[model samples]
Structures are given as C-alpha cells and as structure tokens.
Target: MDVAGIARIATEMTDFSTKEAVGIAVLKKAIDINAAGALALIEVIPDNSQSAPNLPLNLGRNINTIA
Candidate 1:
C-alpha cells in the first residue's frame, strides 16, 4: 500500500462512487503504513460463525441505486 497503489485505486474508482470501494481504499492505506509489520487491514470472520458482542450493524443487504 504505497502512494502508487492508492493512486491506482483512485484512478479505477473514478468511474463511480461506492461505499465498499472507499472502505477498501482505507484498508489499503492501513496496510501500507506497516508494510514491514503484520498489519491487520481486514479480518474476515464468517457470518454466524463467530460469537462477539456489540458488533456494528451490518445492513446485510445492498442498494443498487438511491431511490
């Protein structure tokens, strides 16, 4: 996750705006910060497989367009 990487993502995302895309970009930045260390940019926990409390709300759905 270097400046070049961020710029590349930005260029690709210029076509349209999406929350997911933005979130990915943010994670990329975090990973780049600690390139030499173990940077946990993302944690893929299976849905309904883990037990945790006070988790953030997930819409569990996606909107194609703003109506």
Candidate 2:
C-alpha cells in the first residue's frame, strides 16, 4: 500500500531471515559438539574382548538360573 508500510514489512522480513539464519548456525554448532562428545566417549571405552581371548567360548553362554 503506502511506502512506509512497505518499508516496515521489508524490515520485518529481513529481521526474520537473519534470526532464522542465526538459529540454523547455532543448531549446526550444537550438533558438531555433540558428535565430538560421542566420539570421545567411544574412544575411551576399554577393549576388553581382546584381553581375554584364551578363555573358553562357552564360559559366558550359560546363565545361573537358580536363585
């Protein structure tokens, strides 16, 4: 309609676009941080399977059902 109203709408649209871009950037950063943390956790896990290879294969297969 009027030039002032058009200007206000354009400004509001620009503000919304900027906010949306910042939100997306923040989300990507958060995802990257979480992935790094997960990788760190995976790296810290002890590799116990290799430590006791000589044990019998059936050792852990049996469950003691008698309470």
Candidate 3:
C-alpha cells in the first residue's frame, strides 16, 4: 500500500491524536519531515479474529477505540 493507505489503516487501527496522526502521515509519505516527533506513538488493539499480546499498563491506555 501507498503512504495514504498506510496512514489510513494506522488511523483506523489506533487512537492517535491529531499531531500524532500528522506526524505519522508525514513519516509514512516522507512528504514532510517537520511533523515527525515522539508524539506519534501508536497503540494496537486486536479484533476477535486476531490475537494480540497484553501490553504493559503504560501502553494499553488507548485500546479498543475502534467501532
């Protein structure tokens, strides 16, 4: 997939903030390096069909926000 597709999938799969989203978009596309930063942290939440490991308490705060 292209950068846009990757960004979209990342967006849908995680609950990243606006700044984080832009940073991820920029990184994935390499169209803009200005937005890259540590704020782009990601949290993955697996669906019923998928198996996911339990994240540490500090990392699982944004789990299962998707509909």
In TM-score terms, which candidate is top?
2
Flag regions of model 2 displaced more than 4 Å.
51-67
lDDT of 3 at 18: 74
Q: If scored against the real structure, what TM-score would every candidate get? A: 0.28, 0.75, 0.22
> Which scores greater on lDDT, model 2 or model 3?
2
lDDT of 3 by residue, 1-67 (tens): 8999999989876765777888887777774443443234333434434454464444545678688
Which regions of candidate 1 fall more than 4 Å away from where they truly are? 1-17, 36-67
Q: Please identify model 3 stretches exceeding 4 Å from their true place.
A: 1-16, 31-67
Higher TM-score: candidate 1 or 2?
2
- Which candidate number maximizes lDDT? 2
lDDT against true structure, model 1: 0.68
For residues 1-67, could you state the per-residue lDDT of candidate 1 as single tens digits? Answer: 9999999899878845676788899999988887735435344445542554455455445576876
For model 2, how does the per-residue alpha-carbon lDDT over 2-67 read when each residue is reduced to its tens digit?
999999999999999999999999999999999999999999986656657888656676899999
Q: Residue 21 in model 3: shift from native, Å?
A: 0.2
lDDT of each: 0.68, 0.91, 0.62
lDDT of 3: 0.62
lDDT of 2: 0.91
